[model samples]
Target: MLIATWNVNSVKQRLEHVLRFLDEARPDVLCLQELKATDEAVPALEIEAKGYNLAVHGQKAFNGVAILSRFPLSDIRRGLPGDPEDIQSRYIEALVSAPSGRVARVASIYLPNGNPTGTDKYSYKLRWMERLAGHAAGLLRLEEPLVLAGDYNVIPDARDVSNPEAWVEDALFRPETRSAFRRLLGLGLTEAVRACDDKPGLYTFWDYQAGAWQKNKGIRIDHLLLSPQAADRLTGTEIHRHTRSWDKPSDHVPVSVTLDI
Candidate 1:
């Protein structure tokens, strides 16, 4: 099974890019983040026409996520379980079975991007990560093939960013933020791309400002994390870098994993 993730920025505006991707990549499943639109606002028919069943969790003009799969989806989860007051449409999960009857639980995540250092927004980001950690710990016990994919908005390490010095004061690169991310991996979840390739320039996102893309100033914020069972079946990982060059394309590109399910 081939599963992929991309932060389309806005599904409505990126409909053409999304459709083109579905046709070209043909991944069995795709987890999308940063919809920036309501579920009703998403161009569902256009995507469904490409043979995908979608589970979307969206809010108005803000965070949103979706899971599109070729196979039937069950046990669809629309929101993260740890917080009831938290209403951001940032997480969604579903279970899909490969033709061989193997099932994998997949999630689309748009982790908070806490900008500035000492504010509620920053605090919320940490709290959200903690909630995710608590929830993820529970999922790990299922012992099934689970894939948590999305735009984590985390620059994992100095190697992940083109200019570490430039991001030192940024919330995404803060020590606390990085530590929370490591906690997830410490739970035995294997980062699919890193497991296959450790090359430094393997970035998944580039900013549109200040000639970042032209200078190849990018970061590996987007990720596909696999549970032990899923990691075992992993065959390869790909970062569709060329997608960034497409007309009015998303800052982030599609990252995929091919597994021998």
Candidate 2:
């Protein structure tokens, strides 16, 4: 199965780009983040016409997630567990049954981008990571094919960013944030891109300002984390860097992985 993840920035604004990608890439499943729209606002009919089922967890003007799959989606769940009052539409999961009778559990995640360090937002980001770690630990026990894919808003290492010193004070590359990511991996999850290719300069996102994309100043913040079952079947991985140069493209591009399962 070919599964992909993309932070569209705003689904409405990037609908055309997304449609073009869907038609060309033809991934079996796509996990979307940063819809920046409510469920009613999403172009559901347009997407449905493409032969994909939609599972959306959306918000008004920020932080939304969705899962689009060619296969039937079952047991759809919205929102990350462990924080009742946390209402950000950052997570959505579903079980997709492929035509070959293979089942895979997948989730779209838009992890917090805690900017302006030493503030409440940074604290919340860390707490959210902890909650995610706890939830991931439980999911690991299921021992099924599981994929957590989306914009993690995290630069896992100095190698992931264009300039290590430039991001030292930024939340995305903070030591604590990287540690949290490491803890998630410690739960027995395999980062798909790194597993397939450990080479440097494999970035997934670039800022619109300061000629970031023009200069190839990018970072690998988006990811697809696979469980043992899914990792075992991992066949290939790709970063659709070309998408960044498209018309009205999002700052982030699509990251994908193929699995035999």
- Each prediction's number of clashing residue pairs: 0, 0
After TM-score superposition, the amount by which residue 143's alpha carbon in candidate 1 deviates from its true location, in angstroms, is: 0.6
**Alpha-carbon TM-score of each model against the true structure:** 0.99, 0.99
Highest-lDDT candidate: 2
C-alpha lDDT values of all predictions:
0.93, 0.95
Model 2: per-residue Cα lDDT over 228-251, one tens digit each: 999999999999999999998999
Clashes of 2: 0
- Residue ranges of candidate 2 with Cα displaced over 4 Å: none
Give the Å shift of residue 106 in candidate 2.
0.3
Model 1 bad stretches (over 4 Å): none
When summed lDDT is taken over every stretch of 10 residues in candidate 1, the lowest stretch is: 193-202
